[model samples]
Target: MPSNVEIKAALRDMRYLTQRAKELSGTDGTVIRQQDTFFKVPAGRLKLRDFQDGTGQLIFYERPDTEGPKLSNYSITPTNDPQGLVKVLTDALGQVGQVKKERRLYMVGQTRVHVDSVEGLGDFMELEVVMEEHQSREEGVTIANQLMLELGVKEEDLIDGAYMDLLLKNQQNAHAP
Candidate 1:
């Protein structure tokens, strides 16, 4: 399985981060609209990510739910029939939740900087440090930390778990009596 060092954080200012990312990456970046439907799984996480186009990806990933940069092992398979696949997976594994977001992707060196506006969860940022075959986890962590500094991501702003988890938590809190 391929792996990368990743960090997710709640963002206070999107414009500031966008400007900084453009300055560092020397590109405008790509905007993507995505809807991810998570399924119930035993060990890892499984989500079908629809790109809002005709394309989608079935992704399975495992990572520790930690505040700092952590290693994520994942596999992705592309699909053209996302709706059909979603129905099948929902019938088979049962759907847990879904996350909808508009994401702007920027590349800084080997790191993917994601500035996202989730449907019900507000704004957030994610840093995914793509590791080379010979790279060590320490090296990936070092790179992620450096990028966090450059991107003005504070330690307090760091988040644990995925947007789906956050959305689910918010739902639970809303329904709590």
Candidate 2:
């Protein structure tokens, strides 16, 4: 399994954070529109990510739901038939939820900085420090923390769990009496 040290945070100021990220990374970055369909799984998370192009990926990942940087172990398999796979998976496992977002991707050293505008959830930022085979988890966490500082992300802005979890919570709240 490929692993990374990752953190998700609420974006207080997307303009400032994005500008800082561009200055640090020295690139204009790429914008990707994505829709992720999550399935009910017994363990971990299984989602089919559609890239809005002709390509997509089936991803399974496990990580602790913590407020700070944590290790995520994941596997990804690319597919040219995302729609077909989504149908099969939904039928077999049952669909849980979907998340649609426009993600701006920036590379700062080995870290992937994703500034995202998610539907219904507002804006957020994520830092993924791709871990090398020989690297320790501590090293990845250290790199993630440093990038957090550079990106102007405060500790209070950090969030636990994925966007799917947050969306589901919001849905439940909306229906509650």
Candidate 3:
């Protein structure tokens, strides 16, 4: 696996290469989209037996706050688990529910956009533009701008973090009220 810095450099180079390819082909110039399915398990319950995909994306989970939100650390996800990981999670949570599947479309100059359907959380779309390298902040913003234009994503629709964070916030709000 590449270090963070190396990964970032590679991504930057990839973006540049993609742009050149588009220019040559006179294409609109966007990266091909990839899809990931997540089976969310309660924290601390993940294990080798619990995973089927063998691969995972470590997400920097976050929660909402006045200034925006705070990082809630990373969540490791198995890449592909067809053996009903969601069912296992629901059972662990002691809830008779279904798993949520999301299809995310990512482009070079845009926030990550996903069409998601949760068994209990309902159907929703989410957008997240990640900032990786220290030097690529400006470039990331520019890419986000272009993606917004191409994908018709609005500024107001931009989200701070993941669905789990939103769900936790709502639960807290309900308890408070």
Name the best candidate (by lDDT): 2
For model 3, how does the per-residue alpha-carbon lDDT over 1-177 read when each residue is reduced to its tens digit? 111100111011334444443443345533222222333455422222222244333332323332211222234444355345445544554532223343323333334443444343444443345555453545644654554445444445445534444556666788994
Per-residue lDDT of candidate 1, residues 1-177 (tens digit):
889999999998889988888888889999999999999999999999999898899999999999999999999999999889999999999999999999999999999999999999999999999989999999999999998899888999999999999999999999999
TM-score of each: 0.99, 0.99, 0.41
RMSD of each: 0.6, 0.5, 9.8
In model 2, which regions exceed 4 Å deviation? none
Worst 10 residues of 1 by lDDT: 17-26
Q: Of 2 and 3, which scores higher on lDDT?
A: 2
Going through the candidates in the order shown, the clash numbers are: 0, 0, 4
What TM-score would you give candidate 3 relative to the actual structure? Answer: 0.41
Candidate 3 local Cα displacement, residue 62, angstroms: 8.4
lDDT of 1 at 104: 93
Model 1 pairs in collision:
none
Error of 2 at 62 (Å): 0.3
Q: Which ten contiguous residues of candidate 2 have the minimum total lDDT?
A: 144-153
